[model samples]
Target chain A: MFLVKIYVQLKKDILDAQGKATKKALESLGFEGVQDVRIGKEIRILLDGRDISEVSEKVRQMCDKLLINPVMEDYDFKIMEVEK
Target chain B: MKFGVVIFPGSSGEGDCFYVIKNIINKEVDYIWHKDLIKDIDTYDCIILPGGSSYGDYLRPGAIASKSPVMESIKEFAARGGLVLGICNGFQILLESGLLPGILLQNENIRFKCQYTQVRVENNKTPFTGQCSKGQVLKVAMAHGYGRYYAPEDVIKDLNKNGQIIFRYCDAQGEIEISANPNGSVENIAGISNKKGNVFGTMIHPERSSEEILNSSQGRVIFDSIIGYLKGVTVNGK
Candidate 1:
């Protein structure tokens, strides 16, 4: 078994209004030295596969097709083997 | 002229579009379900995608609905030079389906805004706005969370150069200003048209402004323009 963690976030060029709001809130709460903040989504998936490369390729296709909108967002995934 | 208004499961704007076209505009209109194939799409002079939370707006505002069966027919219709009008969520669908150039993102303030807005007509030559004079201002209702329009720099340049931009958010006097922009759309674009101008998409709900009760007949002009274009084509055999 493998556990996959995917993270999706708006591209750097795209303004992250939510992240900015959160950062402002953090600053108000006394957090300093914060230069930037970004908000992103993390999706976890479990797969029954032994071949790491094949599983990665499938995940990539899934991301490209549905999990991400390439126009405004970017995504990356990490896979780790897990005990059944 | 016949109008086909496509209704996805969660769409809320179909009824308004149908009501305005049939009762107000005095035109033949029908509701086209999303699941059904639009085999006779060519028979209709114009097809409308109205505003609503189609497919619960999952993934993206218009993402799931764009892949529906009827959209293929819409593509074919547009390719054959038929007019396609997308309002609000429909505009999002058009963007998702690649029928339009830009994508709509979350509003700049990250909040849903539903209110009356003023938009200036950028181009009057297109079929969708032929009835309006150049630079005319129309008062319309805009209600959406993801209404900010975004495109790459080059595409934005091309849109400006080609005069594909149909409307830009403006003040009551028809002056484009940031304060009047409900959403932080690039260049204050409130609406746009495809290169051929047959496919039109706008964030504003013109249908909502079509009746006397709405206090704005400006929206009726859009429908009038479409019907006028159809009549012209039939008469000219163009």
Candidate 2:
């Protein structure tokens, strides 16, 4: 079994509409001094397999294939092996 | 050119894309479902992703549809320099598919925005916007709740430098400067293209604005731009 943590974000060049809205909300909520904010997604993927490297590759593939938007998002992952 | 339009289960813009291409642009295109497997994925010259509430916006707009089977082929196709366009929820799909770059955050106002706004053309270099001159201001109808654009300063600057900033929300003057930047978007950007200028994405509904009865002459230019690009590429074989 393997555990993978995936983090997806909009590329630096891409805009983040959600974060700005949050910032606006925080400001409206009296959370002053909030200059700017950028929001992204973090996901944890767990898999059961022997070829952990293959799983890693698959995760990366997922990032580019469907997990992330190549246009507006970027994704990275960390892997850990589950052993008893 | 054999063009394919990706159709997910909830995509409502497929017909609009087809209608615009066939009637407005005078081009016939094929419909490609999200599950359809592409033999080569590289053979097609271009592809378009239509808009809709994929997965009924569950989890997120494109969280489910991005994982559809057609994405693999689209990725391969884009890697080989194939042209692709994602509009509205289609834009969200590109973000999920990693085709363009960026995340579609919820709108600043938290309400679904469906109105006609001005968009300024920032680039005329890509196959998507080659028909218009650089800095051309266009009136496009944007209908989305999460259409604000954001990116880091350096990246935004680089995008501006590389001419990847395709469309921007503009003011009454049709200038993509300050104060008129709706949605508080960074750089007033409304649409974008990849670094290679091949893949493109936008939140506005160009297909909706394509006809004169829609109250805008702007949509035709966008279609003309893409169609012109396709024709030019087809003729030049590049």
In order of appearance, the predictions have TM-scores of 0.94, 0.74
- What would the TM-score be for candidate 2 when compared with the true structure? 0.74
- Tell me chain A's TM-score in each of the predictions: 0.94, 0.76
Give me the overall lDDT of model 2.
0.77
Q: Tell me candidate 1's fraction of native contacts, as a decimal between 0 and 1.
A: 0.38
Q: What DockQ does predicted model 2 obtain?
A: 0.25
User: lDDT tens digits, residues A1-84, model 1?
Assistant: 889999999899988878988889999999999899999989899988768998999899888766777888889899999998
| DockQ of all predictions against the true structure, Cα-based | 0.62, 0.25
Q: What total of clashing residue pairs does each candidate reach?
A: 0, 20
- Write down the worst ten-residue block by lDDT for model 1 chain B: B229-238
What is candidate 1's CA lDDT for residue B153? 93
lDDT of 2 at B180: 69
**lDDT for each residue of candidate 2 in B22-133, tens digit (9 for 90 to 100):** 7777776888878887886665667888888888877568879888889888888888888888999988888776676666766655678778888877777778777776
